[model samples]
Target: MAKVRALDPSKTASSLDTPTDLKPDGVAAVSKALNALLADTFALYLKTKNFHWHVSGPHFRDYHLLLDEQADQIFSTTDDIAERVRKIGGTTLRSIGQIASLQRVVDNNAEFVPPVEMLRELMNDNKAFTANLRKAHELCDKHDDVATASLIENWIDATERRTWFLFEASRAGDNSGH
Candidate 1:
């Protein structure tokens, strides 16, 4: 029940930017794909931020720092993705309204969650994002956009690995107790 500060977007980037090589039609597809990515990334950003703000339990200190790092990384990447959208001749979605309306990632209320529950929820969200990234990369590849595909693929892999690590941490020691 404390005040939470939102990240200032201007400090993150000066303007939207897209790849210069994309053709018009391909740029259109990339634009739409980036829009989808922007939404997903924003949702994940908020989720991580919420976790950072509200997480508590035995793992409070560790999870607190972890969630903060996750939120920072997601915020940076989301800005990059949105800028890429603009570089490809499209505009990045700017409001929570656009993100909430377009994002596929599920948002959870993090007003009061135990640390374990927060980790579980974030693990699930990361898995969902990994899947979404793969699907978007496939579409990018279809448009012969190997650059975008590579970029998304790398992120998907990282997210999947991070989810696995979080999942394992959440499940650790529980078996010994029960």
Candidate 2:
């Protein structure tokens, strides 16, 4: 057998080398916030899709289509969030357990939820998600990670749009107060 060689600690796969000038703490800060946001995004995606699959009543087709569209949008965001972490030399979430641990959004496991209730819950979750995204953007700003911040700006706008659509969908005839 060949002689065993000692591994060099500095060049381990767990520690990635970043091309950017961001310090270690900055990377940690940004990565932590982004991962948390990523977890929440995943949670939101699943919940929206759940509502899409289970939605019923007079507006079934409309709500189903809306939730499907929102789910796709939420799912698309996860990749960007994960890639941003890797771009900054930070490892991202690896498993469902990790996502569950990091996610701030609560799961809805009820056997049945009314279509309007589903829309309202999802709208509230999207609103909270917007706030969380804002917080993450603030952290990115603090770390001067402009790339991440710009991505977050787009996400915030998308989330707000989702919230607006859900809110409008969940209300009665005069929901718009027009």
Candidate 3:
């Protein structure tokens, strides 16, 4: 068996090293864009989870399950976003306050809201997120960060699909048949 080495307790946070071929300015720009995306993702995840827990009406089960699944997908992106920041030699969000400060998504703490309204709000938020992702993807492209741009492309497609589903689900009737 190989011997295990102990971690050096003397190492400080600033001592962490991130080596990359990308310039410092490019890294900073990409990291800033990714941080904004991360913040929005976290905010959206919380809002979706809140809706999941509070949702009610004739479609309670369907809405609750949809929100839960959507929340999980949003949460899944946070780690990747943060990791991308670090990979590019920059830091990421550190606290709830930091995330709240950076986030653009609006919070809903109302005691009650109509289920249709909730669905509409989330659909709009997802659309906004996709817009933000597109902006970030452009930044990545500007910086020539192919990896991050590719990831954002996938995210954009996924968000568009979410928006489509929500729009369809919120429709009042089978208008497509007309």
Candidate 4:
């Protein structure tokens, strides 16, 4: 097998942007949309993990495992989203502050959110994510970027599935110390 080389430092400069056929404006629009999506994904992942760690009550094990699984799924998309930006000759987010600025998902800082409430909130977040994914897919279509649209389609389905699970989990089973 041939040895692979890392990114050439000089060639990775901003002036030497990755080549793409998409219009410059299209790249900018899609990159901006994708970065926002990425930021929301990160926020959702962290909130899922937070709920996973803090969840209490009788059904702790099931809720914890579900959240862990969902968090993993949410995190798996970040690299793809960010790399798609670079592939389109655009930059991706570089800092937590940037993520916070772009993220639309609301943060949860409550000292104690009831377990059932947590499920409801996560479900809503997933629903919002699905909506955002649809919007991104539409933007990608406008830009004639089928590759990113395909990825967004998959993410939309996954997010809807997560929302469904959360809905079921929180539907009626838990008491939340009532």
Candidate 5:
């Protein structure tokens, strides 16, 4: 097996290592914020996956594929968020129960919604997720955690793009006159 190269100790912030450079209370606050954002993103990913599986209508094929791709992106981002939390001396809560109890985003019933409605719901979800990520980025900025903030900015930009695409799709049908 190939040996895994470890991240540079100076750059690899361990969940176990106390942040001696910052006030302890500041570290704890940032950790709490990151955990909340991570769980929320996880919940949004599940909702996206559900929509991908159940969406049906005139645009069913395209919407389904898009949702699947978006869900995969969200899943990948969730992993990054969780790992960053762990790197910042905080636990990444992974259990379903933990995510369910801590997630700020609410789950949607994807099976019953119309295709256009699903797009709307997903857009709303992404907007909410973006808002939360922005808040987390602000908190990270307060603590001088530029690494985590940069990661979050990437996620936020991706989510905004996804949301805009979804909303545009929803509007496309309206402009066509039946």
Candidate 6:
């Protein structure tokens, strides 16, 4: 196996010189919020994909498909977020360790978790993610970064929908024979 090299954060300061009309402080604040959002997104994406792959039960197909779709949606936002950071004259996350350090979402690495438990966990996570997005949106509004705020608004709606679906899926009812 080839030896892996660690990323040097200092060497990757390309966004430092990028010009933007926004105040530097505002840019910095929004960038920080976006980084946190990106980190949580990355963590959630991994967790969702893990559940997608590991889910095994009577509702395996439904659970797997839902997770897969949600993971894709989460992964898709990462690029837009990173680019927005750069667009606003701020640097973005550079490594997995950086992302892990900034992330607020908890990772679930258990070999086995009940389907209901998984759904409940993801539902809660999605809700938490929406909260983070709202906080970021507020920062954007404070800074008058309308572009970032708009993006965050869309993300908030998407996350809320995901949470609703997970909540409904996790409900114990006659259909589930629970």
Question: Which ten-residue region of model 4 has the weakest summed lDDT?
Answer: 1-10
**Candidate 6 Cα deviation (angstroms), residue 140:** 0.7
Error of 2 at 167 (Å): 0.7
Per-residue lDDT for 89-142 in model 4, tens only? 899999999999999999999999999899999999999889899999999999
- How good is model 2 by TM-score? 0.89
Ranking of models by lDDT: 4, 6, 2, 3, 5, 1
Candidate 2 has which clashing residue pairs, if any? none
TM-score of each: 0.81, 0.89, 0.88, 0.89, 0.84, 0.88
**Predicted structure 5: lDDT:** 0.80
TM-score of 1: 0.81
Q: Per-residue alpha-carbon lDDT of model 1 for 1-178, expressed as tens digits?
A: 2222333557764354333555667788887878988898888888888888887777778888888887887887876787667655577797889888899888887458777777888899898888888888888887777877878877887788779867876775356642
- Where model 2 places Cα greater than 4 Å from the true spot, the runs are 1-15, 173-178
Task: Report lDDT (CA) for all predictions.
Answer: 0.77, 0.88, 0.85, 0.91, 0.80, 0.88
| lDDT, candidate 2, 65-169, per-residue tens | 999999999999899999999988788999999999999899999989988899889989999999999998999889888989999999999999999998888
**Model 3 TM-score on a 0 to 1 scale:** 0.88
For residues 1-178, write the lDDT of model 3, one tens digit per residue. Answer: 2222233459753554576666678888999989988999999999989988998988888888888888888899889889989987889999999999989999999999877788889999999999999999888888788989999999999899888877776773334642
Number of clashes found in candidate 2: 0
Error of 6 at 126 (Å): 0.5
Residue-pair clashes, model 5: 1
- Poorest lDDT segment (10 consecutive residues) of candidate 1: 1-10
Task: Enumerate residue pairs that collide in model 3.
Answer: none
Best by lDDT: 4
Candidate 4 residue spans exceeding 4 A from truth: 1-16, 174-178
